[model samples]
Target: MFPITADWMSFVIVALATLFLIGELLVSTKGIFSILGLGFITIYFASFLDPGMFFVMIIIYFFGLILMIIDGKILNDGTLAVIGLVCMFVSVGFTAPNMVAGLYAVIGVFIGGISSFAFLKVFKKRQMWTKITLFDQLTEEAGYSSINQSYKELVGKRGITTTDMRPIGTVMIGDEEYSAITQGKWVAKDTEVEVMDVDGTKILVKDSEKLQKKSAD
Candidate 1:
């Protein structure tokens, strides 16, 4: 009865940790929840058992941590699921041979560390693949009137063109992008253009003249 109770508690601890770790992944609140979850599982495992059982629990805890980090950082969802199943098999299978306990623990930690490193490298590469843009002097209002606020009123307002325009294009103001006709015609690519008139999304501006004025002011 006592052994069964302990087992149940251990299971609960592990289950809660796993769920919390999963939550950390979905909700991107940084790794706070995940670290908490790991702590819970570690305490539960380490506190409730005898030396032998404690050692085993430690192995399982570290194994689970590695699995989670790999899941989050390296493997896609499907692949992580598969790895989870495999880890379960390993944890369960190692129970029979007490002599090889240390080996199992070492192996689990090694797999986890390697997978985590790989995940970090992949994440860095992904960041490199993305492009970031900045726009200044935007308005929170809507429609042509809002456009006017950003352009005519915001004589020194700066904005980014969302779409390409032969001479006319779209510029962002606050949270809204306005249609702006260029001040001196053709505005190419992501060239920083200024707001001249607020017709609507229709904004009129030369290349960065208004931005310059805003900076001077």
Candidate 2:
């Protein structure tokens, strides 16, 4: 069923491989999945390589994992993540028992990434990505509150741009400051604007003077 011609055994092997390896990233299995992942990956490599090369390939695979952690935690850019994937694919392809196993391993990694999404719902993610992902919505202390029905009241109100709205900026509506955006228009600071829409906390606005001029003409 894999891209390459994988036998029934290859299916079982890749499933366990991805399960433990990718599963570890998804939830905090507390070293359990790590141990299982290492064991399965070792078995997959041992089927084809000598003791010397087997250890080398294992190191490369873990190195790829380290890069992924760096990408997720430190850099937050995707550069390390891509490099890490290439490293892992190379390790698997080079050490697999046959062409079929190599393809299966690569496919397994992809499925594992997709499957990781499921963990976010059921499990508490303690990973670094959690810190950067929608933290404002997670807590009110960080200055993020759910958009209440009252926000609709200001939809037609006029305001002044507190900052340059290069599409997204802040505007002051009456005495309250709100984060708002323009309709793909560049608005300068201190310029007058009118709220056009409020979808939850997303406030969309347009230049009030431009609207007035258009209405007058």
Candidate 3:
């Protein structure tokens, strides 16, 4: 015969909630367990009747939230485990008519508050997470090869500007139009200008003397 006040059901719920929290942490599947854990705790808390018990539950919930922010993974898991143990002990050890209800209420509060906070933190942080890419490493290697190549060899190199660069524009050097800084002052249209210097990707050039003299007028 189960005590009218204390039942195995409370212990079972707490145990299950703890497991859910653990699962959520281990799997890193967002805040699924966090939500469920809080829901279980809320239900348990509601079943109990003491004003003082609710207050205690609120305190526990607040503590868990604080721990969650600073401690994150460790606190999230630890709080659930501790609360689960407490709930199990209270449910099984005491048969007072109001004991189970009070304990359940506390458990609910602990789970709801802690889990909600944990879930929100995880959700917010997830957005900023970035995956490591092989291209990042390759960029350095590629840049080295690109830098070592001769720009002077491109003196006569020709390319179209991808963007209008006022007096300067992109000139297709081989497959890439480098940042062509024109020396001609103003080389409108796709007028041809020889590569004067290929200091890095900046291609410096001037309009042919004929064009320059005509523009000077």
Candidate 4:
């Protein structure tokens, strides 16, 4: 058995290790929390444990962390994360020197997991966090963008009138020509105009001078 002065020493080590490990997983700390947590966890594993079983338990524990990362970051489904948490708690708990120590370890894990939530406000997010939340932002991308998305893209676009107009005329936007009209202002053929509005099939044009002055204001 590894040397330990008191039962509380295991609790402290487990708690600290669990805290830092969970913190590292939850947010980006540039690996500082991971290093510190790993150190404490390694120390805890080495103390009061059989050498032969040490590597095995550690593997089980780390495997749990990997599953969590996969679930939280990759899958975004809770299935693997739940299993991972169970694996981690069980591994740490079962490895303790006694039932009391085991209970402390499990409590430490819970406390660590709960407390790690606070880090969200202070730290930059892991890429996986995006998967877990605000998934509805994609609703804008799926079909809401619309075929007339180009209509909005046309806003402020520059075009030239193809034919003379008292007000209504054909305008060239890029290589493709579009039917357009000015705001009740007469314009001549080949004059440059900016898209003022597009409503279904109707396109409105503005003179460059008017558009420039309006934009400046």
Candidate 3 TM-score, true structure as reference: 0.31
Pick by TM-score: 2 or 3, better one: 2
- Over 116-204, each residue of candidate 1 has an lDDT whose tens digit, in order, gives 33434333223311232121334464222444443467555776777776776777756777676765577766667765555654556
Task: Please give each candidate's TM-score.
Answer: 0.31, 0.56, 0.31, 0.57
The reply for model 4, stretches above 4 Å from the true place, is 1-3, 127-217
Residue pairs with backbone atoms closer than 3 Å in model 4 (clashes): none
**Candidate topping lDDT:** 4
lDDT of each: 0.53, 0.77, 0.52, 0.79
Global fold similarity of model 2 (TM-score): 0.56
TM-score of 1: 0.31
Highest TM-score: which candidate? 4
By TM-score, the candidates rank as 4, 2, 1, 3
Q: In order, how many clashes per candidate?
A: 13, 0, 14, 0
The residue pairs in collision within model 2 are none
Q: Poorest 10 consecutive residues of model 1 by lDDT?
A: 128-137
- Candidates arranged by lDDT, highest first: 4, 2, 1, 3
Per-residue lDDT of candidate 4, residues 184-203 (tens digit): 89988988898877776678
lDDT per residue (tens digit) for residues 49-160 in model 2 = 7899988988888788789767866787999999987887788777666777677777766665566667667776666556655444544576555665578789899999
Model 3 gets an lDDT of 0.52
For residues 1-217, what per-residue lDDT tens digits would candidate 3 score against the true structure? 2222455466555545554554454345667777875565455544553566755653454354444433444344566656544543443233223665446534643553345445444443332222311224435555654443666577755554555557767766567666778765766655655666677556786555554577799
* Alpha carbon deviation, residue 168, candidate 2 (Å): 20
Report the backbone clash tally of model 3.
Answer: 14
